[model samples]
Target: MILNARSSYSRLLLMVVLITVIVSGSSRAIVHAAVNVPDNIRVAFFINLGANKYQSLTSVATLQSTDGMNLIWRDPQFSLPAGNVAAGNSVRFAVDGYRALVLETADLNAAIAVLKKIQASSSAAFVTRLTKSGKPVYQVTEGTYSSAAGAKTALTKWTGSGVATGVQTLISARVAGPWAVETGPYSSAYEAEIAADQLGSAGLDSFVALKPREGALEYVLRVGQEQNESTLPALQEAVAAAGGLNVRIPAAGESYALIRHDMTLNGNANKPVDFYAIPAGSGAVLRADPAGAGGINLLERSKRTYRGSMEVSVLNQSLAVVNEVDYEQYLYSVVGTEIGAKWPLEAQKAQAVAARSYALSSGMGYNIAHVVDTTLSQAYFGIASENAMAIEGVNQTAGEVLTSQGKVINAVFSANAGGITADNATEIWEGDDSFLTAGAESPDDGPQKGLLDWYYVALSSGQAGYIRSDLLADSGQKHISGAKYLKATAEGIAVRSKPQVVASVEPIARIGSGTLVVELDKVPENTDYSWIEGPVTPEVLLASINKRAKPQITGPLRTLEVTKTGPSGRATEVKANGVTVDVGVSDNLRGALNGLKSTLFTIEETGRYSILNGQGDQVDSSGQIGSLKIIGGDGTASSVTDPNLYVMDGKGNLRAGTTAPAFNFLGKGYGHGLGMSQWGARGLAEQGYDYQYILKYYYKNVLIEKDA
Candidate 1:
């Protein structure tokens, strides 16, 4: 995988002497050990090439390391961060290799002719220049592959008329490395880098590298090439006072060596490089100095920086960028992103513990990684999101996690619960831990005090939901002074019985844009906490019901209503066109509803007619309109309703009796009402509740004891 056009990344291959021992083939025990509280973590920031949050697939990634970048070294048993990622200097890693069957020709024209001939058989053929035995030469090659064997196998079926019988397999790479005399094995890459820089200033090919210690990594300064045992004595002797060793670095392979400045050879972008006697890559770690002074940075991603080092490796056709960070340092960013860093310290602490617990139990990204740096798991935005208070919260609650039955709990959370947390996780996970239990909602002071901001509003029929603040305009205190009302800007929207977009729910009333409605009781302008979505035509709603509901709402959608609700008043089951579709959980209902934010809502109809029964009481004729008769002024009776009917409007104009109803999902909250609600937590924290108390409030009867 191409990480960057030019990039350097690797750090913390080991933690302690024991870790080094494990990595260096001493013990295999730790490899299989379960993760409880990991000292270091791997968070994949770039998945494939286009898989990052930024969605960029550029072949180059630049990195700056504070501890100095380390070279990666691995045997069948271990792979770890080795040494020298320096500060200020940018190290680049890029995807720069391909395997191809090559034919060397002394002349460029001959190579081009051969390339053209092969192109007829394979679309990837190319011609480029290389050096052979001190002479410049041109070569024709074809195909892209991460491994040499893959290219070799492809050569067997050659069919080009001009194909060379003496074809050689070549792997392309951009590389620069040199052999050198080594200095002392310092304790840190920072120390080694300073020494290497002094030599580099004096025009030596100097750099820092790492070697495994018992469980830690030690750094060495090396300077280089053109010197064998006889010629290297002078270079070694100068460092002999510092315990220098006479070391000769060998050529680096494309597997671990990348040329920072070399993307093309002899003006050919696809040509393999000639190392020019320099050591290209021997799996030697070259990196930004992270162990020295400054932090590591992802130069292309808005220049977002990080406290920890990075691991850049090949994955499929693109590079994988993984952030290697201390678990606690990781929380400095995660805690702030999950819960507001400016929020109460207690709330942040709760988020820290929960986030930690969730990461441990989530089993995400396989073992190659623990999690992704996105909300698909949890938002991890690097150092920019870090806050002092949030860091303090992380430090104060370090190593703590929520566990039930002696195991970590999957502490799931969301933005808002619409005043009630769903009680369905127990059903999903098949456990009855009290920590996952939730009770009926009491009162959420968050929306009341306006601290938990939202565009709250009520319709003329006394029904309400949160509206997007941007959609509403202030009434200019038109209703009353010192009191503001929001004027609805658009009309004829669907109002559903549930906030979800599920088709199983029958279409309800359509609220017009100019309908009189009350604005928020607290702040006049707010968020998605309450919203109205649509006035869906029956044709549209029917299609959705059939697509989502099992047993598929088989006919035209006549009536859709919530038939059952969980303890939190979240719709769990509904009937579409009067047919029962047993949606067993609130979350499932939410999923079936085109991923609506919540399931707490009410439905109303605009064109619906009501019947005055014998008791003189009005009954809505929504789904049963055709069953009743009406007495006209002339005492003549006719059928109730027709599909092609017109009626006179109040303005003395004629219009269709039914305008094909649509629905508006008017409800509070922005996520699955499960476990803790971010807004609710903020509200409780404002009410002087500590994180522990808040956790118990949302997650019932669960103890907030520290991890055992």
Candidate 2:
């Protein structure tokens, strides 16, 4: 008996070891060399789909969702086979509502491959549908229990998957229209069956079906027959866990791979392949043109042709087009659009390196793509706008990326720094970086406008303006007046009256700096180097401030003051009526009131102030104006030369006087003034500074290395 027990124990130990090896090996299979290399980054050219103009999708290749749960085909001459997803038909779910895990991708072929891997790894049924916003997502039902408790229990089992998991209480049957996840139109049924078997082995259940291909018989592998939407991220995690298969849901509508093949242009055929997506519909749609004979308009702002694929999906009730292009190719368009193709070679090279580093570190496209095609990421227009100079810059700095302690750095840059570089923490959100430092600008001739003249004029109706230190007559005493008065009474200080009498006069309307213009020294050659915006009205300021915040503010905006300045004289804290309302990154201050050219400025108001008497009236030289007032001059009345001269108050009230209330923004520089300045780099290059010197000067203690 003892001998038999010992033999059984040895067998059990052997079984345990085998199981451990298989589990560990399966985990490692998910990541292959191709996906691991960081060689190329995916960019979502289109994300917002509400504005999509596509009426339907037409493609020659069969399309499917990422889960291989459904199939869509469009051929004018042929009918769809049984079990295939019919165009214009909505996918139905098992229960009134079901939760699912989804994965999004711009490539249909890749989605199918990923779906097969997911099927092999997990024992869950998946469905495909365009999100309400138009993104085609693959979903797996964690559980279709009668109660939410059952769903929660199933979700708990996915803790090790690391996917975005959630429990959705489906209120009704999800009517996700027919979407497809398909695999090849094999030459024969036997071949298709073999492929299906492989997929089944991988854990994906699929079937073989006959389909038309180029006027011949063909068989295709298809899956995704259910239509229940669950926590969509679960499937993505499952695929990732199974074997690191890359599959993503397409934008809502129909996910398609847009291909622009060889075309005759100017009597010669040129091949520049590109891809796009469209919504799913009927009538030869799957086998038709991407835009249905009408070419889709993409990246309309720069009017450039994109040589990459796009995923069109609906997001937030709007249509978004995401462009997925290679990292180096994207840099071609960005370098040119950002610094201009006409810039110096060295400057362009520096910019190329900086842009590349910024793109990888920004993490803006972590969820969908690597980066956007707008200024939100970097200015990327695609291949159509590629210029020779920009191309040269990218080639020269190929595979170069900025690194700090073996990690990529977030290389940020701007237009002009007004002669001073900003500290990273001060200019942007508070963060310490060894690279960006506060110091004098590199270029000796870097955007210097000198000390410009500023002034403050006073007006009649209690409006006030700024009087320059040079223009001030004397450090005079301050006085209060008008219907509202402050006095030290026996019972503390009393303002206005005990019953709180409402003043008949409205509060002084502080005008924005945009209203007044100050003639100042500036870079005459380039106008954008210096700019002016508002004497913006209070209403406008309020509206703009409210848009960036919540709990909407109420305002007749009384005042705007720069409460703090950075080492470079950049506005760090701005106060609106003694409240610290302006707080955020660099853009907040510039965009606060009708847009200020830069934060290096001082506000000047012009107006006359006086002390108020006990009767709540202006106390003039003689007495209270309402009680016994007499207008008088110092010894002799001063005479004005200009007859058109009118004095205005802080409230915009005007009357005959020597001066009027006006404001001035005496500031310098353009852009956020952080990191490397484009013009500054050019100036440095002109001064014989190489690209390395320029980069080192702007970003201190940084190492330049090839990421390739």
Candidate 3:
């Protein structure tokens, strides 16, 4: 039994060693390279469905990767959202983890052969040649394989090449594997990925791959996976990122090699290519193979055709050691003060780009080194050089003092200089100078002729006067055809009707300032006062007026008398001063009075007239009445002393008891009370008050901060 147990233990130990080796090998494979596939990959394609505009469709093509082969095709029957599918339009498709390939044909046999050819090529050689329509086709670089049978098995699952039999064939080719191609020698993988993503967005599948020649990994972008079709456009955009073009592709059946020939030697042997980095300040400088060597062989690697270049102006550079507080303050001062009103839109955009670039590159930790693009010539006043330095990351805010024209000026608070207000006569002015005045009498001696200080002059009816420039109260001034009136009290009041009692009432003239009045006649003694009709009362009635006196009425008054016909019926006989008067049944007494109250009646017998209440009970009466006072025949009191108010026509003939429509005074402007309008802020700014002062006066308990 002991021998058997030992044998079993030895077998268990062997199993453990095998498991350990497998786990270690698996981990190492994963660590060999970092996958450069983006989490979110976007792709688009150009397709032609048919010739007729009515049936043609440019739809998004679907893509997928199985094993080492990538399949790409369009579903013509696929229905997309309405208005999304258009003829001759490009369609965009996006997917994560896998790259996109445009297959030239749906034929499985042709694609398998192409994959085999690519797999056989060297690592540096990514492009493969294919024959389409009996013509040799050169395409984007792809992978190579050892045998044609192996390639066929891997690509057998794909639905044959989708290319048509006759037309020039073109399609995307996607391959699986970490294929690496040199895209300039980048120091960081992050930079390589950035370039790769840019190329991928342009419909080129690329990634960071190891280059054994350099002993350092560089970004290698592949156009197609198994098949090589035209990818020159995508490669052009990617090369432009590094300001390179004139790229060369291998010819059909050519091995992986970059040939450099010295044209100066006529037929000299091809030499190895060299690469160099150009300093940022040198504009359009040619890159050299060695650090500082200049030789004619550098031109040997040049490919024919002009490649477009991307120019990024280094307007400003900042040191990487600045703190957040100083950086923010510096930015604030630059935007709020230096470039406040004088900087144009282009300069502002440049400044913003510079700031963002510095923040991103330096990680908000390092001091910046600034370099200005002096080629741009635009005048920016009030912008300090120190502020520019701060933006470029050269100096911190606290350590630098901004000098305007070499002299430091303390921050000054601005005030409201241009505005309109009641204090200044209504007028319009240009920059605190009286341009025009409006409303009221001309200034011979009445008031100031020109605009008030910090006020505008607006002329209504061509009248000139001064108004607070900051208080452009009037959007526009309007005039009433009739004369204007001034009140006696500073606290202006509106009255319905003019009142008698000369010593108690103050008379106001049209468009005139309030004038003090003195009484010259003895006040009349009466319990009631009379109502005057007009916009203003006579000056004689305002003399010695009691400032607080109110209007009252007194006189011999004749009242309308009525007698009831039944317990609940209308009145039968209505008389004024012992004469029969007309009485009409109406909903409102005011309406009935306006319609029939003023009919003149000839008084056959003079007697006191009493006005009965709605219940037919006597309320009041005239103590004594004369024959001429009561003179209406239609039961209306025309000339009765103290007759009820009624309407009259243009002929001055009384219209008995006719109701007149109520009057409405149409008002202008918004808000309660009349003073200090808010819409006038811009006018105030133009007049002279700074924006801060305007806000301060308009809003209470507010503080302005640089950051805010």
Candidate 4:
């Protein structure tokens, strides 16, 4: 019977995998006698494509149809149980050469009814069998055809003529005709009748059938005789509206009949088949024309050549094309993009193994595709990105993978870590992965060492802060003075300050522009061991601190201090104003401070204060250095530093002027200091350490083994 698009979809023979394996292992040998790897994985290349809303790949591509569906190499064979084919009017189709567009349902009675309905429209035949789910299903078609294209044309032309509601679209690999629909897999015949009765009461036809599963008989209430889509909806809707009835449409495309082609004395009965349309030499050709200048142009820019079968299907409203490829071959482009193709051989091999492990361990075909061609999973650029070194890496590793506790590991890696790697829970999202722990691998010299000495200043307040030395501005001067500038003393050049420096004034306070006027040679050439920041104004400091910290800092930002640190001397906790914040996990602290480089820093205010008198009304009057009055002469103050000691205002009160100080930060390192540091790896490689050693230094207790 003809069905609408939705009804035809409902009539689809849903093919689901059912695997049962029994494995045995001993010290002498390991046995995998029952293991079954699927011959082909079905990926939804497209779903509901275009304004025309076609469902099958053949429908969209206008490929040829056949008397029987093209069978995969592993399909079980069967024949139509009844109808014209059973009545000797139909010829048995050769499994290899011919195919048919069959409507499949999980119920045997429904299959017979559908066959009768199709026969009423035109002369058609059908067959029946049991699905892996133990449900009786049916397969039926119009006539057997030798070529797929001719069959497709016949199905399309016949369906378009408005004879059937919907054209049969699913190409069956079986050489049978009868189609069936399944209803109930009830525990008892009584339960099956209850379901059948409910459908009968709702003006739907149904019956009870028995099937065997795992050595037990199951009673199923088979529903509907016609495969036409238009008739079932109203019945289903009525049953649903009636309520209290456990009626459900059979799952779409969930059942397939296993058909076998039989040979007769008149030579081989079935024609030879191509199985899954797989070409022998170059693999299955696809829409991507090999004759084109650069093969297929992906996303309109990158042209790529792929070694695998390509299948196109509809997804949502657009087309989804999947490249079905071997797992190892998929790594060629991945390794080349994840790490440069020119990387050291050992490093590339390490990367290849890691990528392979990740791919094998990951569940592919999630979004109807094996893996997206992006870094969201692994960076892939097809054949265009592959190189000799990448191929060598793949070859060397072969089927190798890093496994922990008998399962493949998820080897996650990142770029440079400044110097040290952080714990997995500490650097990435909170998770205690023992494999990812903090360790020091990067050298503290060379260009790597130059990452520390950079510095920044509050452009408005002259408050200075430190960033990575490599990120510093080119050619700028900060004319530092007061306690920051060194002064020659009896003991040597030292930071000039009061005896009780912390208690007396702003710690590390200075005046003028806090620039690094010292010669470049003063800081070692290839070393960037430290960074400094801020004499920042209250407003800017508050904004920056509140942005990164939780519970938003209240009041004016008064102080910022490193309250706690991790093993690498990186700040794990900090205090903004009076609020103590924990930044121990991930890169929370770095993100909090905008771009703090790393969290190893100390806080300092940038201005000095004068000692006040005991009365709290005036500057100190004692005859001491930096006091308001340095000396007394004729009851008057005199000193080299005292400019206006006792200037009387109009009210005869002594007044003096003072300056306010801003805040500053001094720090070290860059990033969260987690995982493998790319720069550190390079340095280690330069120092004769191999990639395996580098990986071991960062990730602990992982065994690199080849998959059997």
Candidate topping TM-score = 1
User: What are the per-residue Cα lDDT tens digits for candidate 4 across 1-708?
Assistant: 778998666556332111112222212122223222223222223333445533322211211111221211211132121111211111221111223445555444444555556556553243433232323334444543434555566567544554334434233332322122455467665676566655555544345543333444455544543323455666566655643245566553322221222111123323211111111111212222122222222322233555444443234423345556567767887787776655677777767767776666555534555455555456777777889998998887777766666666667665455456655554345577676657664652334342333222222222222222332233443333211221111221112121111344443334232333221112222223344444456677667667656678895554566776666666667776558854446357766665566655566543222354446554422223243343365676644352212233445333222234355556555445555554565567667766667667766677666545
Global lDDT scores for all candidate models: 0.55, 0.48, 0.25, 0.45
**Candidate 4: worst-modelled 10 consecutive residues by lDDT:** 81-90
Better of 2 and 4 by TM-score: 2
lDDT of 2 by residue, 1-708 (tens): 456887989988999999998988653111111111155666654343233332211111112222222223434565342233233222221221223333333333343444444445453334332222223223333333333444444445443353332323222222222233456656665676565555544444344544455654455544332243343355445433433223343233322222111111112212211111222221222221122211122423233455443443333322344455567877888997888677789898899988988898876543445676666677776555678988898898777777777677888887778778877677656679777756756462444334332233332333333222222222232223211111111221111111112357232333332232121111122223543332345567767777764444566455556788888878787666557764366557677655766676665432113435457776432111123222346544333333123333456443322132223344566777778888889898878877777887888777777754
Q: Which scores greater on TM-score, model 1 or model 3?
A: 1
Return whichever of 1 and 2 wins on lDDT. Answer: 1
- Runs of candidate 3 with Cα error greater than 4 angstroms are 1-167, 172-338, 341-708
User: In model 1, what lDDT does residue 685 have?
Assistant: 77
TM agreement with the true structure for every prediction: 0.54, 0.49, 0.18, 0.41
lDDT: worst 10-residue window of model 2:
492-501
Q: Is candidate 2 or candidate 3 better by TM-score?
A: 2
lDDT of 4: 0.45
**TM-score ranking, high to low:** 1, 2, 4, 3
